[model samples]
Target: MRRATTGLDLALAGLMTVAACAEVVISGGGGTALGFGVAATLLIAFRRRIPLVTACGVTVCLIAESVFVEPPDRAVPMFVLILASFSVAAHANRRDAAFGLSFLSLAMITTGALDAGDDVASLLPGWALFVGIPGGVGVAFRKRTGDVAVMEARAAAAEVAALEAVEAERRRLARELHDVVSHAVTLISVQAEAGQAVIDSDVEGARRALAAIGAASQDAVAELHAMLALLHEPSDESTGSTSTGLADLPSLVAGVRAAGLRVELVTRGVSALPPAADHCAFRVVQEGLTNALRHERNAQVRLVIDHADADSAIRVESRGTRHQSSYGGSGRGIAGLRERVAAVGGSLEVLDHDGTYCLQAVLPR
Candidate 1:
């Protein structure tokens, strides 16, 4: 882009130099006038790079032509001065542009006074018409270009922010769906297996397992619908609702019990927590119970929700004599839980010792 601009500048300088020389010859001006015209016109090539210097050089040439040669026609010199004033105003900073404009206008006024023997007061308005108008137009053009550039930069930043927000929403939705579906599906699978095993021997046990499966499936569908509704109209409070949180622990515990895992839930000062921390606590417990059910169905799980300290803590410990390999899950659930906890400015830890597994999370308010 810069190279193209330079090429255009050089081309414009060459053309203007030819025009100035032609004008001087047609006006029957001498070689001195022709020389001054070409020099003033050629200085325009450096206007964008060193606008103040170019304007000063052009002003000197114009004044010298009026003083020394006193050309029959001063049209070419006046045109070159106008072009220099505009370039200086457009390309230079405010202070330098102001100085250049004042200097060029004063030089033109002095030249007019010297040529016509007119009063400096009478020449002021004419010089201003030649220099001031072009400078003002150039300043307006510069301001407009700067405003457009600022708006474009802001629009680009907004687009990037919007994209980042969308990606974050996608990640959040994936985590929520994974937790809801994984927990419910695992329950349904276990209940289905239990029902199949006892279908011939115990009719009542089989019936209960089938009932649990139906309940788990229904809950899963309701949660999915809620998430979908959020997608349709996120700003509509009636449609957008959250998934399970700490307050729903009773139902969660009951569901796990129905799935054949023994869960003992203890609460201490968990009356009020921020929504993020509350939801994170629920996911920790849910993932922990789901892991216990999948690996050690008969294990006794002790779940604790404590918010007595400055920070909230959740702990789920499963007591059983299962092999370490049994608890080695695909790691998705734990990773999701960790991400959830971390997002809420919290930490998650999982421990396995002596055939026992523990999931612990600490969240800030």
Candidate 2:
């Protein structure tokens, strides 16, 4: 693009030089006028780079031509001056452009006074037509171009922000799906194995296990449908049936108990929190219980939720022998939980000592 622009500028300079030289010769202005015209036209090449200097140089050449040659026709020189004036206003800053215009106007008035003597008043229309109009047009063009550049820059920034927002939302959905599927699958697997082990001797026990599996499957399907609804239509409303909070701890604990893990729940203070923090706290407890179920056999788990003046705390502790046939994990559940807690300005910690494992999180209100 730079090469193309440079080529066009050189082409314009060459064409103007030829036309101005021809005009000088036709008017019989002699060698002096031809030299001045060529010099003025050559300065057009550098107008974009040093517009004020180019304008000043062209103005000097025009004045010199009027004084030395006094050409019969001033058409070419006036046209070159108009082009120079436009370039000055278009490329130069306001102070420099204003100075260039004033200098060119003063030079034109002086040149007209020298040629017409006392009849300088009659040259006002020519001065305005050749210099004033072009300078004003150039200023307007510069302002318009600046406005367009600003709008383009703002549009580019907005596009980048939107892309970032989309990527963040995708990560959030992946995390939610992972938590939901992992917890339900873990419960169903444990219940199915228990039901299979007891099917020969204890029909009632097997039937209860099957019922738990059915319940877990139904819950998972409902949660999945709720998540899918968000993809179809975004909303500011809470996730309705799928949105879990402190009040749902009893049901969560009951489900984990039905899956064969022993959980004792304890609570303190009033459970009041912002939606984001409340949701994060629920995930913390859910992830902690899920990890305990996957890794421990006959584990006694204690879940504690404490709401205080400044923050909310959740702690899950499990004590049991490690399961010989424990389920494998991809290690994303705890990491996702950490991200969720951190997103709401919270901190999570996990500890293991001997046969005991503890998960703790603290969230600001």
Per-model lDDT? 0.82, 0.83
- Model 2 TM-score (2 dp): 0.88
**TM-score per model over all chains:** 0.87, 0.88
RMSD of 2: 3.0
Task: Rate residue 62 of model 2 by lDDT.
Answer: 73
Please give the TM-score that candidate 1 achieves against the real structure.
Answer: 0.87
Best by TM-score: 2
- Runs in model 2 lying further than 4 Å from the true structure: 1-5, 71-73, 237-242, 319-327, 351-356
RMSD of each: 3.2, 3.0
Single out the weakest 10-residue window by summed lDDT for candidate 1: 234-243
Tens digits of lDDT, candidate 2, 303-329: 988999999999999998787445667
